[model samples]
Target chain A: MKAAWSAEWLKLRRSRVPWMTVLAISVGAAAGGLFMFISLHPGRAGDLGLLGAKAQLSTLEPSWPSFFGLLAQITAVGGVIIFGITVVWMFGREFADHTAKDLLALPTHRAAIVAAKFAAATVWCLLLAVYLTAAGLGIGLLLGIPGPLTVPVAAAGVGRIFVTAVLTIAITTLFGLAASVGRGYLPGVAVLFAVVFTAQIVAALGYGAWFPFSVPAMHAGLTGADGPSPVGYAAVGAMAFVAVTATIGWWQRADHTG
Target chain B: MAVVQVAGLVKHYGAVKAVDGASLTVAAGEIYALLGLNGAGKTTTIRTLLGMIRPTAGSVRLFGTPVTADARSLWGRVGYLVETPAAYPELTVTENLTLMARLKHLPAAAVGNVVEQLGLRPYAARRARELSLGNQQRLALAKALLGRPELLVLDEPANGLDPAGVTEIRQLLKTLAAQGTTILLSSHILAEVAKLATRIGIIHAGRMVTEIAAADLPHHVARALRVRCHDQDTAARILRQGGYQPLSNLDGMLSMTDERAVWHPDEVATLLVESGCPPVHLAVAEEDLETLFLRLTARGAGA
Candidate 1:
């Protein structure tokens, strides 16, 4: 298991996919900051160009608490797409690059390989979550927000943002399944887009609490005031369990034709 | 004892039977070559042997131990390169070998040693993405050769290599075999298989048509003596009178498959000369492996 993890880590470090994931999350963070800047002073929005005077910031609040909520929403919405791709690429490239066959029949078991990949994905997603919070806080400070980040307020806001990121990461495990069954990045990416779109529609229909993918964005208040119920968290746990089991089972049992 | 054993290995995908009751055994120190054409089930059989695919009904044992996907202990002594060689495109050659060494649980020194063994030192620091097809193949081979594994399973190990590279690889396999490492390789290139393998198994349409020692391959192929004389009719008559049945093909040359005639062609020449049909051209010819393979497959040996 250790060897497999190290091998997975080495490949992850050397590949451009990790860099791409970082870049995507960084852009999401910067975009979150941009939206906050625009909302704080809507009249000066013209200086920011196209999304300027025409865009409305009616429901948005120009305060630290609201900024953290915006960041959590970004992590929920953008985190799924970015982290989904990261996990998908981790598994999909083995097939795309035709390296999956080499991994089989090694001293290390296939289950260990699957576990190592999941571990790497988890680590990267957590790093992105940390970056999202840091970048959001930095941007809010730069904009000179009026609300004080009291200890209790900061803990509540950051904890909520972290949980949102975790939930988003949990559901993206399905992309790994898509990558394995579909055998490449394109199929997995297609699945990721489909899941994200369906989540939006499902959440809008007020069934977000029942759908795992919809719960993350809803928990982050992407669907307005209502947060996820305990049922939503249970659904997220079930999705994670199913995704990990299915991915590992596929790795062990499926014919690795590649 | 057989280092590798497979019996009645049948793998079916929906309506297509990719491998049907195929079986072979590679004893310790033997180089067994699974010879087949494209889509002839060579890769499928190799995959099953490596536990990449479960056989629909059959068994595979490596080193007298049953092989399963989770069987880790047996793999320590086994190294395999299936189908085309593959590596992490972003990692350098050395890094790739190092990773493989760790996966195989070999000493760290195995990395440099395998790189040197495969003549990959020049490209060690170069990323795999920059490598040519041939170098990528060498890197794959380097990964397989790490730790001087007791058994090597290679599929078209010579693919993408130049003539010199092929010879080098062939010599490397020979050296490994000489050191008592069992090798099971697959290739459609009969010449390479003939030169390297101690035994060859010909598979077609997902079944083993025949398995023969490499040295005995020529003997299994049909051999005959061809006689072209001033009067082909007279030569045929003389050969028939001499109790040897002669046959003619499109070229209108009388040929006899009589083992006696094939062994003692001088007797046939003398008989023809005595019958006043001095041969214009008389030569002993044997069917090549390609012709035998075509004949065997066409005959549906597996059917």
Candidate 2:
């Protein structure tokens, strides 16, 4: 398992996947700041030719708490897409590059290979989450919003953002399984997009609490004021279990003809 | 001792049988080639042998141990390259070999050794994506040869290589076999495998049609007696009345493969002459490998 992990780590580090994921989360952080800037000064919406964008900012507050909350919300949606692609590419490239065959007859077990990929992906996604928070902190300081960032408040806000990122990463495991079963990046990406699109519709229908994929976004308050119920967290837990087990089992037992 | 043992192997994708009842045994220190055409189950058989695919029936054992995904220790002495060569395009050649060496539990020096062995030192720092087709194949082979395993299973290892590269690989496999390494390779070229393999197995339409010793291949070659003469119809009938079964080639010339006709063409000439029909062309010829493959594979002719 250690050898397999080292191999996975080297491939992950040498590839463009980490850079791409970092860019995605960094951009999302900056975009959150821009949204806050527009929310704080509504008059600039029209004066800067931003049209009626101010109407959407009516519920937003130009405070540090709000900034952190906004960052958490973006992490929900952005983490799924970015982290999902990272995991997808990790498993799918073996098929896309036609390198899967070489790994099958190795001294290391197939389950060990799958676990190593999961480990590398987990490390990468967590690093991206850290970057998102740091970038958001820098953006918030630059905006100079007048509000409380008391130690407890800051801890709570940052904790919420990290929690959202962890939950989002959990769902991305399904993307890894999809890529392994479907045998390429496009299949897993298709599943990722489908889940992201359906999450909005499911959350809008008031059942986001039960839909695992929508649980993270709703817990981060993507759907207005309502946060996820306890059942939503259970759903996420169930999804992580199922996805991780299926992926490992698939790697161990599937006829990897490709 | 036999290094590989496959028996009654079968694999089916829905209604399509990919490999049905294919069986072969490769002994230690023997260079065995699985000779087959495209879609002849060469890749499927190789995958099953490597435990990359599960067989619907039959079993594969390597070095006296049954092949299974969980038999991790069994793979330490095995190295392989199945189907088309592949590598992490983003990683340099040196990096790729280093990673493989780690997975194989070999010392780091294995990387530099394979790079030098495969003549990849010049391109060590180049990413796999930057390599040409032939060089990519070299990298794959280098990975397979990294730990110097006791057995090597290479499926079409010579694909995309130049003639010189092909000769080089053939010699390398021969040298390895001479040093007690067992090799199971696949190729559709009879002439190519004949030059290297001590034994050959022919497969077609998902079945093993025949297995032959390389030295005895001369006897199994598709040899035929050909006769062309004036009044071709009369000459053919005369040969037929002489208890010889004849068939016409696409060129409208009569041909037969009976041992009597091929070994005693002078008897045919005398018969045609007595019938007052002079021969224009008469000779014994061997068919090309493609034709031989068809004859051996048709209806599992030699199975």
Candidate 3:
């Protein structure tokens, strides 16, 4: 497992996609800063035109908590796409590049290789979460949000953002399984879009708390309809367990002739 | 000692039988080649031997250990390259080898050794996408060579190599086998396989049609003695009376495929000379491996 982890991390470190995800999350945080600016001065929104129209879509306040909420919301929503790509790239590249056969018939167990991919993804996604929070803090300080940015406040924000990131990352793993079963980038991306669309429909139908895919967005108060109940988080955990296990089992047992 | 033992291996995908009852035993230090046409189940058989696909029936074992078992350690001594050469296009040649070495639990130094072994040292720092098709193949071979595996399974190992590169790979496999490494490679280049393989197993339409030893290949090849004469009808009857089954060939010549006739063309000449139908031309024509392979595979296809 350690050897697999070393190899997986080396691959992730050299890849451009991980860094691209960071930039994506950073851009999301910067956009959050813009939303906060419009919330502080609503009249300036009209003068800003399209940027203002985009800012007005987010109902934020000039406060640390509102800024944190905005960042979490972006992660909950954008993380599904960005982090899903991270997981998808990790598993799908093997097939897309036709290198999966090499990993099989190796001294290292296939499950170890899968686990190593998940571990590397977890670490990178966690860093993306932390970076998003820090970027939010920097953007807020430069814009001068209303609340004082104390160490405790910052800690609390980090905790909340990390929790949201974790929930989002958990479900992103389903895309990894999809990529494995589908054997390429496009299928995994298709499943991701389906999950995202289904989550929205399920959440809109007022059962968001029960669907695991909708839990993270609800937890982040994407609609301010309601925060997810504890059951929703548990459901997310169950779904994550299933995805990870099924993926490992698929790697171990599935016919890999192609 | 047998290094690879595959018995009654069968793999079926829905209605299509990719491989059926294919069996072979490869002894240690033997360069065995699996010869086949397109879609002859060569790849499927190789994948089953590597445990990438579970057989619908039969068994495959390496070093007396069942390949079907969850024997992770069993692969520590085995190395294989199936199908086309693939690599992480983003990673350099050295990095790609290091990644595989790590997965195999090999020492870091193994990377450099294989790079040198495969003549990839000059391209060590180049990204895989930047290398030519032949160099990419070299990198794949380098990865397979990592850990000094005792058994090597390669499918079309010379796919992208030049003529010189093909010769180099042939010599490398010969040297590797000479040092006690068992190699099982599949190739369509009949001439190359004739030069490299100690034994050849021809698979056609998911069946093992025949297995032939390199030394005995000449005997398997069809040889016919041909005779041309002015009085062809008289010569044919004379050869028939002389205890030879003679048949007329398309190019105005009488030919006999009997082993005795081929072995003693002198007797056929002497008989024709005494029978007033002396031969103008009498020479033995032999089929090459390509033609023999085609005939054998065509026979297997019917079966």
The CA lDDT at A222 in model 3 is 87
Q: Residue B242 error for model 1, in Å?
A: 2.4
lDDT: worst 10-residue window of model 3 chain A: A50-59
Please write out the lDDT profile of model 3 over residues A52-155, one tens digit for every residue.
33344545767887788888889899999899999999999999999999999999999999999999998999888888887888888888898778888877
Candidate 2 residue B48 Cα shift, in angstroms, is: 0.7
**Residue B164 displacement in candidate 2 (angstroms):** 0.4
Each prediction's number of clashing residue pairs: 0, 0, 0
Q: Pick the candidate with the highest DockQ.
A: 1
List where candidate 1 sits over 4 angstroms from the true fold.
A47-54, B301-303
Query: Candidate 1's C-alpha lDDT?
Result: 0.88
Per-candidate interface DockQ score: 0.82, 0.76, 0.80
TM-score for predicted model 1 compared with the true structure: 0.97
After the best TM-score superposition of candidate 1, give how far the Cα of residue A183 lies from its true spot, in angstroms: 1.5
TM-score of model 2 (first chain only): 0.95
Predicted candidate 1 versus true structure: per-residue lDDT over A1-258, tens digit per residue = 999999998888888877788888888878877777777766576665737445666777887778888888988988898889889989999999999888888888888999899888888889889987887788788988777879887888899899998898899889999999999998899999999889988887888888888999988888788888898899999999899999999998888887
Residue B193 of model 3: what lDDT? 95
| Alpha-carbon interface RMSD for all candidates, in angstroms | 0.9, 0.8, 1.1
Least lDDT summed over 10 consecutive residues: which range in candidate 2 chain A? A50-59
The better-scoring model by lDDT among 1 and 3 is 3
Clashes of 1: 0
